[model samples]
Target: MPLYAPSPALRGRQLAADVGLLAWLVLWVVVARTVHGAVLALAGPGRAVEDLGASVAGSMSSAAQAAADVPVVGDELAAPFEALGSAGGSVGGAGQAAQDAVGTLATVLAVVLVVLPVGWLLLRWLPWRLGWVRDAGVARRLATADPALLAARALATAPLTRLAALPPGTAEAWRAGDPTATRALAAVELARLGLPADTLGRDERRLGLR
Candidate 1:
């Protein structure tokens, strides 16, 4: 037997879901890279400078230890210790600097993880609610929809390219799906959008789309 395929509606919905996931993943990657770069830059003089300072301090301590073990240069090693002690004065400053850098990284990551999704949702939902503000830059013909119909449009979020030339009412009924009123409203809407009246069935037409 041949494998069964989903209907066009099911396939379209799945494709939409996949696109949303891909967009979110791309956003997260960009955010992560940005946060990492900021933390590194704010570390001031970068990781290389901090590592160099630590290496120099460690080498000086090792040299002093060697000198003291040899007995003859014990006083010379004491001099080296004083020099190291002076260098260590900036240790606290470096730590504070690193802490501040890390804090900024945390803040940025928090915004990307927490705030960005909320913002995307608002942008996604809000325009559909308020018709005047939605992005309608494209010259595509949109269904002249009331608020509920508009809400359904936003919820569906179909790609403009994939949308078939639907009778607006049938599309709205499919979206809203109130069995009591759906067929009736769909009939009127189909007539309004110039679709065939038979599309909603004879029983639906007899029952006024109240």
Candidate 2:
């Protein structure tokens, strides 16, 4: 059996849905970007640990330099103190590096935990939504439509090149339990563009639509 073609009102509703979804996405992207900035600021730049390392090394070196300036016993003490200063410096440097690493890790974590999931959702929805956008663009004429207009759309999407390529008019024939050529052609086109899958008998009672 031939498929149902939705009325123009239904088509309009779908077009609006596609457009609304796009607007929704624009809002979502703004939210995502704002959240990203917030996360980055909260995470910080890893400088505090680095500064602590530098401070510890500097203090130990200062003590060593003062102690090393004295006499024979001072010479031995000075060497040990110098070694201690070097160790402290190493510790400080390690702390700085560790903080740097932590900052890097936090950045990765934020992207994965926050942005990636949102990105994934956008990836999933956008393609389907874009398809609707394209379909709507092609079927825009359906907003102010007719049998001929719908038929024109059907031909645009499908492989059917000529009306002669399809079965004869179904609307005229449908009453006698057959379909008309005009509806048959339009239906095929609408089907290609993904329309009219659900139709009502005519509380839809309007003209120029299914």
Candidate 3:
């Protein structure tokens, strides 16, 4: 299958468009990564809170141990410190939960940021590129297999202005199997596809028609 137009100008444009699309995808990926990092930065405070809670829990646990060594009030004194330690542990859990939530948000937002615009562009661009490849392949085969078919396609699909620009009686002559008119019409169709008009001439020579 033909991947690009035979014409130098059209081929160059296709190449440029492909390169641009690659660049666009790379740019968006970089942007998504940057945004993800920025969002993840918000977790710094959560980490600080977790550390503070852990520090408090450890200190309270140590104090409770020390308090248990007291005489009569030892058990009662240790109870309050144990309660404080439990509260600190709850704070640490809350901090961890906040960090998890932030991490999830960062991932989701980054995915959305990359998917929407990139997917939309692909939806619009892929069909046209694929269509060109299909049409060009068909045109290439038909150019050799049946120049008359290409002539007929030109008569049916070429703009009226272009049709009129052809020599007078060109369409009527093509229908009458006039070689000149058939070649002319075929050239028109080939030009529209950015194929060389000489493709028809080569086929004619191979068939001993020239």
Candidate 4:
């Protein structure tokens, strides 16, 4: 049920790691925003082109309207202006499409930049953190309910060097139901997990060793 190690040193390290992860995420988010802005800047030329096209279209449309009022050859003169205005409108449409494409590209790039690194880190980190929480919770419960189970787990999982640091024949003694050996082995496992000795309970006599 604990989110951190009972040991101050281990708990401090865990807290530091959590803080580092948060900082990393924030840093990448800022970077992504900056990149998005930079990429969006590429749309400036498209905006200029769209404005120029619109101006040309508007001018030609007005010219066409005026020329249609000419005395004799009005229709022939207005036809060319109308055609030029349609061409300008098409150019404006193309510019708008280019701006839309640039916007889409910028968004995609920014998302990929953040998602790849941050998501990769989260994928690696979240499972380990959650696994520790689950395992530590189980260990805490077993420490109270059946510390022998913890001792057995230590025998199976603890490094041989660590087991050797205990009294000679500690494993054999544990197999023989020696309460001291059981408590010692259990303590080894608890300490490995950064849990305190008292997690086995204040009264050693009440432990499941008997």
Leading candidate by TM-score: 4
Q: How big is the positional error of residue 17 in model 2, measured in Å on the Cα after superposition? A: 6.8
The clash tally of candidate 2 reads 13
- Candidate with top lDDT is 3
Tens-place lDDT per residue, model 3, 1-210, is 778898998888888878888887888899999999999999999988888899889999999999999999999999999999989998898899999999999999989988988898888778878988888778778877788899999999998888899999998998888878988898899888888988774578664336
Over 4 Å off in model 2, which ranges? 1-55, 72-74, 137-210
**Residue 174 lDDT in candidate 4:** 89
Candidate with better TM-score, 1 vs 3: 3
- Checking candidate 1 for backbone clashes, the offending pairs are 184-209
Candidate 1 Cα misplacement greater than 4 A, ranges: 1-25, 31-35, 38-44, 67-114, 122-210
Candidate 1: deviation at residue 83, Å? 4.8
Could you arrange the candidates by lDDT from highest to lowest? 3, 4, 2, 1
Comparing 1 and 2 on TM-score, the stronger one: 2
Candidate 2 local lDDT, 1-210, one digit each (tens): 212124566556556655765676576566655655665554344455556657766877787788877777777777776777777777667666766666666566645655565566667666765666576454544533444556555555667455456655543443343324445665666655556523212322254243
The order by descending TM-score is 4, 3, 2, 1
**Higher-ranked by lDDT: 1 or 4:** 4
Checking candidate 4 for backbone clashes, the offending pairs are none
68-91 per-residue lDDT for model 4 (tens digits): 999899998999999999998988
lDDT of 1 by residue, 8-46 (tens): 553454456546756876687677677766665666654
